[model samples]
Target chain A: MLSDMQNNEFQTYGYTFKEVGLTPGEIARFLKVDPSEKEHPANVFIHEILNKLPDNKEITGGYRILPVDDLNVKEGRLACNNVELNPGRQVSTCLQKSEYIALFVCTAGDIFTGLTRRFNRRGDSLEAYITDAIGSLTVEKAMDGIQSQLEKAMKKRDLQITDRYSPGYCNWPVSEQKELFALLGETPVPVSLTGTCLMIPIKSISGVIGIGKEVRKSKYACAVCGDENCIYIKIIKK
Target chain B: MEDLLNKLHNCVEFGKTDINSPYPPDRKGQKGALEYTQELLEKGASPTNIMELALIPAMNKVGRKFSENKVFVPQMLLSAKAMNVSVHLLKPYFRTGELKRKGVFIIGTVFGDLHDIGKNLVAMMVEGAGWEVVDLGVDVKPEKFTEALRQHPGAVVGLSALLTTTMVNMKPVVDAIKAESPATKIIVGGAPLSSGYAFSIGADGYGKNPQENVLWLNAIGYAK
Candidate 1:
């Protein structure tokens, strides 16, 4: 189901609704509809919004792996292929034994953003909210796709990998996004940072995955943060 | 005339904008809030009666449902839009002091936060509640909020931040506003904020969502 989504492309972005793995419950949560009210107008409206969405398009991602040279765990600093990084405590602990790090950027593209703006302009906030939620889910699926590709490439070399860690996650400051973008050279996804370090398209994400034998993959890390409204927390609870 | 007022109320409640709007499928081809409001005014309905009897009551229901989580942002926004259609028709009366707004509401996204969806939602909801809203837009500094308070005395203030990092900026803005006008009622909200955090930063109240903000404003005597 996931690989088939990668085959679907629109303009510069490859996407598929199937890859997004969106469920009625998830959509309902984003729409703030009661979970039991399956026939609510908001639910119907969400369905219409989903149907209006471009089927063959969702998200795109780009990534590159670089060897890590010098590492100072005490100072929580890392040097990977001449790119100095202060990944902070959380990322440092995750990447301590990594021989290489996969740097990646993923974006849900401009279609959803444009549609959201259009809906907002037309006074159809329901459509805008539903579309924006879908866009967020798309970016996550794109990141998952990138991780899977990286795992596939590493399998041939008999290398295991760690869980992905992103800037603004754990102790890594969001400012690190600039360095990640710089290291990627020419990003496959058209993700750009705003003056305040927010990614453009608003649904883009950047992260690094450590590659090595001793690196452990964390299945759920919602415990690291205490945000009750986090989607990850909701998913984990489910 | 009473029937027309009820029609206008139901139109706003159901987010029916006009006869052509297809939303709330049941009301698809009916004359919506837009048409009913215009017709009522044309047929000698006072702006004050229309607003007090229909628009405000419909928005109040919308606000209450929103606070109870029975209605979400989109539904509330649609209702706000429906109410705005009638409010637009009443603007002339407001200019002549014939129709008084509930109160002024000054809102903005705190500095370093470019996110405005939450702020915009609050602005629309407050405006729907019959208050005059002055949106300072995104990335507003402490001075900007204080300056706005100076211009619109006794106006309530709201600060929003989507990021945890940026949410910290609300402290300084709240402090600045309090320093300038101690009587001002300040409310804060965003994804990363809790009531505890808001209280810690000297905010008078914290709304978990837009509807709660309106309720808080009402509780604090900002109601019409």
Candidate 2:
């Protein structure tokens, strides 16, 4: 693991696929399959894809810890050192206790999407579907590992961290990707955000975590959120 | 012929592709949907009967299982793969006009939204239910949908979006279609969407899952 010494600028975090260690059981929870069922095709497919995971040297993530300059609790708005954000009332409420906000971006990279396209073009949709699901799980697991590290670092300082929150979930507008990138600073994030706020690599994830002594994640907003499309909601269900 | 239809149903319901496929493990070496469909047709089984009795019912079961949590995406997709291949054998019958379709369904991912796996899954489910699906693909502008409706008059429209931000774009597309054809029914589905959202946007129905999309179409008189 390589991390930037915490500074005003973003720190690059790199990990091998093994470091993420996305297990069949973890992915199974999302897929609604019993990974313990050895002969189950989904379990079989998960293993097949796991064996093909990219080597450990791949750079998977980058994040920046931004000090919260101001908080407008009533309006559910906040300002970082350089950006003003209205991640909506739900997110604002969840993040209110933060003294610093960690903005992060991570990805499963081009290899997975490339394989998905190849399978789709061949009309092997089953293969494409399985591979795409794996890609989504991979990036998420990578981010989880990064978050764990963030938690550990904060722990040493006797500070705590909140659960992750991303744009387009829990009332956060995805167009805030531009604002998030601005927060990440001059070194461009490996993942590119489209004009529409859709990420270019399509498998990349960008989000925030609140770091403060009192900011403990009580429960996922997905429990009360209307966005059934959220992957975290799926995890919660699992 | 009844035995073959039963075999086809099990093949699709269980995700058995063909004799060479080894998905379900128990049905590893069995002749799957493709082989059974051919055999059924060879035995002079009516195409309409085969679909109503076999394909539609199998997919409906799969869809219900998906909704009930008895099955998941991979299983639904596996059934769709089996349904698609079997449906392929009936394509000639459809194109030649011997098999009449229920109606046309024009579907697309709303503008500024590039996600389409949900769109594609719903499209497959609708098609399996015996509707002629006209998929306009991802990032479709409002005009593209209007243009498709112009070509496919009396067709039902489906708008899909997977992002909370992009799901808002559904309103503009709905507004565009309703402006051109007041009577056109538009059904919307995607993970971020709800019936309330669909109602607010002037859509006729909201499909919580792909199976419900089929049910909505059926409820609106496009029965096969």
Candidate 3:
């Protein structure tokens, strides 16, 4: 329902740090530390990292919406218009009500990657870890801003949206990033996927959200995922 | 000498690196692993005894505690740091054949996978376990792994990939290593891997954690 978006309209956004608005409580939660334990090494380390993530470094994201015409539950095949993607069973089920699919890629710039690499090279393991965690948080925070903007646009037309899902997470194999990137059609999403399926910025995220009048956002269900090694499991548990 | 070695073991186990290290706050400002190691050598204690009585036991204890979640990554890294400085004191003995490492471990992140934190952690953990580690860095090609195998014939290989996409690349690398070095053992690990995936990819072992990998190597009689 966004005025600028049609059946497959690509839209790119640049977000300021104020828009992303990372908080100390969220950073502490991500690092599995208590905010009150400010002197704890991890907490102390995160403070230094947060101060280094300059607000001037703007985050970026791009998204395109495509109409979904087919869904093969058995194979988790999703045929949106002409682009066919098999993102796996769980994803297909969650997206059953979708009239459109929003393919999105967001990144937290490149500074954190360099910071993490520097600490790692210096053998400062704890510093490197906290920096990496902050980078992860920053990218997701950027994505949250983008998603909120889309939601506000949808509200004008009384449209609803399902929760966003990424290829590497849940039951969808990370290899599907190849297909997802191809669907973006080189429209300059600003994030690149390597041959090995990793996003280039190192602090980047790519995924899809379902949009329709009847579609609804649901709480994340970790029980349906088969990946036992996911770090999110620990986050959710804690 | 035995008492000094015991003190050094405690230092390494508790993650006290040097007199200046403020970790294990109760032991703050006290002489640490490096200091104890130097003092023991000045007293004419055998470097081999320092390794056997102090470093190995201390690292094994840390590794065990980590596997049990009694300690976490930061604590484990701290212990490894203490062990590294102490081990540095015995480098000359190793060069002079007065001491011997358990064996060699050649490790790298699989090709196309740029992530190296997991690989580095494993490499450091193996090094602390007394292996001479050859870290090939990240984005390593299959040929590079086999070539390293050629140079260190009896060395075990460790493959790491932090993404599911890169995890798929492990199968081919395992195949290439098996083709060239039939007797070589390959251990695969990363965030997205399970023992099932490792077995399916033809890896000889799956290191669920760094401690598990160390235990596997120690159990295999790699220390000669």
Candidate 4:
């Protein structure tokens, strides 16, 4: 039994490059160019790509807090109301003390994917690459919005929320995305899973956040994750 | 003619695709690789010379900058795009055997890995470097690679896998290709791959990025 959650009821965010907190310096870093140079050609290229994005485009994400019926921290599993989840170590470790959990889905939407494909077909792969990066940043910003909303809701209940944990992260296999999507009830962001379990819109993300008074967020979760290629970790190091 | 060729090289190096392209603001409204290549050809510059002098040198500079970490995929892709436009104008010469391609290179992402950004980058870079690239698209199987090898004999192969889980799948592809053609060089790359892991999986080389792969191909005499 799944309950439909209205997309309008949850906090959703739309972003431009500036609103997403993406700086030229960060874009330069991602491009592996010298950020010290205030007027690099890459910076100009970044601006050009930004200007080409649709003004009406929005990357929306929202979450619903669901009651957890049971949780087993040692076994790294949880039964959240109607959905039984084996969230794995990384998620369960952060979720053990939670009374409830929030299931969230965020998407940069199909517009960006369509734009990327168009650029690719036109042989403007540079624009395609930049658009793809922008999509990533948009989804990340949407996730940030979802986290803040979850935090606010938890605060009203005298509880705190743990860091966001997606199924593909750490020991939680990507195959579990089906269960996560199922738990979220109706699609909040129009993201679908492929036959192989990969997310469509390519830039969409889904995750779970534990809500409890004792759930503490890690200061630097990227450090513990061991994925050296993570953009967040790279940004922190720089 | 030399001045026009030099301008064409600069256009490609800086990723100026055309007069309408707004990138590299300093060159705004200036004729880019497309116009410059056409103008150079009109001035009676040899197609082979345009490739060897203008396109090849520009791509080499881009590849070096990429290896030095001075440019990322966006920058590299721009440069590759510029080079591609110039190459397109010279395609007639290639078809006539007047402008020879270095060799055939087949590339694809391994099965279960739907990611194509990295694969596309590599394919474009290699194509810009004067190779004839046969892109097999994404989620390719080992048999497909072997079949491609059968079709394009003596061609080099590239496999990409963005996920750690799918990276392990490269071993089977590598083994299958090697079994079919022992002389064929196989390279692997993606976010989760390292040169050490590439070697462990029987891959001949591992490129940290597309530029590195171009460099490796050059080093192995894949380019003339």
Candidate 5:
């Protein structure tokens, strides 16, 4: 059903589950939506994709992570507080292949398309627009699924996940996206990293989590990040 | 009536909702899509006709604009909001047989994929195109889709996944559905998915954006 161009774009623009060090079952758990049922659209889609998924070997070494504390945590140093202090634990996983490819799609399509469908129902733009607001409200709940899974995984590892942070979150610059990509061995997966650091095709994600042996209170929003919240109280605008 | 339709179209295209909505600065305080659509229906325009001539066409334009990159996510979302407002006014008609939807379209993010923005957009867009949309919400499993299909036998399905890691899981779900109900059509989308990925997984359709899906469905002779 997919066009040739669309198929090619998908191949280049997105990554497979194995490429990101995850299995279908693992992902299913994180999403909390099973694919075995016929009623779920996501399950149907996933079922189709898995049909052609290549069996890639598990890649052992691609990422090179240097703890923030080891990099530049000495006294009298130009301090950037975003750096993880005490340089918490580190863990990395990747596919068995030498490289991989990926993409980045946006959340915009859901809002627009969702609104159109709802409005058509009422034949009244007013009610549909209100529903649109309600629909957008679900974004938080959606992301919650991911956060909860990560939390569970961390707990199992006897580690505390300190605010699962993506590349562009807080002081983590977009430039750093390249670093993570390199660590993942982008060339093997054949992922194209765009100039602006956005993974093309709009579905890819790269992030880092500070895994600490101890559980500590964390500021939810970047604005109140504790490192500076106590001393300067300069809210890092989210 | 034509002027009102034009304004309504513009409101949806430019993301204007009503006097209170301020996102699209170009048309502030003007009666937006919400009011215009209601007015059109009140002034002897059939909801069906209004949907066809005004809402559908306007949304098609917005969808085309999105595909061509003329508008980004935020602007597209605005237009969607306007379209949604217009749809809400005509919902009851849809329920009582005053209107007939083209077909059923089911959509959701795949299991283990919680992101809903893309899936929701496709659901809305397909629904706008006059299809009876059954949204399964995010993190939907294969069995849920099959179950929903059992409930709505002839419905077309759309799958969405935001993560590359979870995209592969769509395969088994598709297989299960095809095994049980081979006649059901499936559309796969999301950032990580390409047309190749969709077909590789054996979906019946692929849409780059919500508008494309509408056009594709239209070409299948469902446009009204």
Candidate 6:
């Protein structure tokens, strides 16, 4: 229903939703919306997923890598687990190093539905609601997307994807967004970054697939990278 | 007097919500869009005159500033806030059927993606341009969009994704919408989205930002 502009915020943005449910207060604060407003149903599920997020695990051998389009020998060696991690070992005894590794990452991709209805109601701050919902959904989607891609890419290579890693995770500095971008030639991939390196569209994903002989580079690396607090993590050593 | 509109526009453009609100340290304590809008309204100003001469122009400026990288999210949020304050004052007349929206829009972040900021911005900007936006929230399934389309008939649909991985999910949703409602226009956006990608995914349009989405909607002559 459209109307002449009055002091109506709803009219400014037709339908709107505010962050509602569990962390609605926190999200509302982040989105700069009034938290006391009626809660949106989407926020309920968002909280549910957030609460249930499995601890982030560096799932070794969880995925395989496949060249989505082309695979050239010039790109380096493509060896299965044949390559030995010991640099001093005989080269002939090891699998040839593939110049670059392209693997699909995957994780359990289950969240809830009806988020919009829960957030955007008949009478509410449409803009504020949408903003809050965007923030919540983006992170959830991005993480899942990256995980899923790793899983899929690795399955193709027949070699397991050591737990996916990005530059900023663990010892990896946030500054690696650039190197990672360069490695993937991300500009052509439709993904971009803000001035502060925050990924937009919030639900987008990114990750790294190591091209090494050791199944996981090293078990220690995997342990350090495991997000023990993640809702989906299968194991939590802590 | 000509510069007064620019000043008012800038106040809103930079996100000065009201005369009393303190933000953007540079414009602290000054009359904001809220005051200027009310003042304009009381001065026998036509609604169209206020919109065309002040509000629209201000948003346009903000949009341009945003495109040029002179401003970022915080500044844009402020501008949106200022614009909202003025719009809040204009709501009653519309509810009374004194005004009309150009059309309806249904938007959301695709399944597996829970982000909504970019979608929200588009919703706001489109609404400012006189569209009734039905925000489906995050992780929206295609059926919900189809359901909304069934209800609205010709409403435009916007899909947002912030992750490269979640963008894949958009294809199935778009396919579903196209299968059920061939004529419903769809728009896609987010960090990992581009015009090329939007076309590949079968969306009718792509918006890089809220302001751009407004311009796109207006350019298609969809607004009445």
**CAPRI grade of model 4:** acceptable
* Sliding window of 10 residues with minimal summed lDDT for model 5 chain B: B69-78
Task: List ranges where model 5 is wrong by over 4 Å.
Answer: A1-238, B221-224
DockQ of each: 0.29, 0.58, 0.51, 0.31, 0.02, 0.02
What range of 10 consecutive residues in model 3 chain A has the weakest lDDT sum? A226-235
lDDT of 2 by residue, B67-146 (tens): 88788888898898988889999999998998978899999999998887888889888988888999998899999999
Q: Each candidate: how many clashes?
A: 0, 1, 0, 0, 90, 75
Model 6: per-residue Cα lDDT over A68-166, one tens digit each: 222223332223223211111211112223223433222221222233334445333443444444434434334444555544544565544444444
TM-scores of the candidates in the order shown: 0.75, 0.90, 0.90, 0.79, 0.52, 0.53
User: Interface Cα RMSD per model, in Å?
Assistant: 3.9, 2.1, 2.4, 3.9, 15.7, 12.9
What lDDT does the true structure give each of the candidates?
A: 0.79, 0.84, 0.82, 0.80, 0.55, 0.55
Per-residue lDDT over B1-224 for candidate 4, one digit per residue giving the tens place of the 0 to 100 score: 88999999999998898998886878878999999999989989999999989998898889888777676666777788789888989999998999898888999999887788989988988887888999998899999999999999988999998876678889999999999899999989998788999999899999998878988887886343
lDDT of 5 by residue, B1-224 (tens): 88888888788888787777754555667788888987898898888887877887887787787778576444555677788788888898888888777888878787866556567667766776777788887668899999999999887888887655567778988998999998777788876568988999898788877877877777664432
Cα lDDT tens digits for candidate 1, A31-132: 556656544556777667766666675477766777778667788888876888898866787677887777777888788778877776786666677777
Worst 10 residues of 6 chain A by lDDT: A7-16
Q: Over 4 Å off in model 1, which ranges?
A: A1-60, A66-100, A108-131, A160-163, A169-196, A210-228, A231-238, B1-4, B42-45, B222-224
C-alpha lDDT of residue A108 in model 5: 17
Lowest summed lDDT over 10 consecutive residues: which window, candidate 3 chain B? B215-224
Categorize the docking of model 3.
Answer: medium
Per-residue lDDT of candidate 1, residues B39-95 (tens digit) = 999999989899889998898898888777677676787787788878988999999
lDDT accuracy of residue A176 in candidate 6: 41
For residues B100-127, write the lDDT of model 6, one tens digit per residue. 5567888888887766657766776776
Cα TM-score of candidate 6: 0.53
Can you tell me the CAPRI class of model 2?
medium
Expressed as tens digits, the lDDT of each residue in A186-230 for candidate 5 is 333323455446553232334544434553325554444444211
Question: lDDT of model 3 at residue A13?
Answer: 84
Highest DockQ, which number? 2
Better of 2 and 5 by DockQ: 2
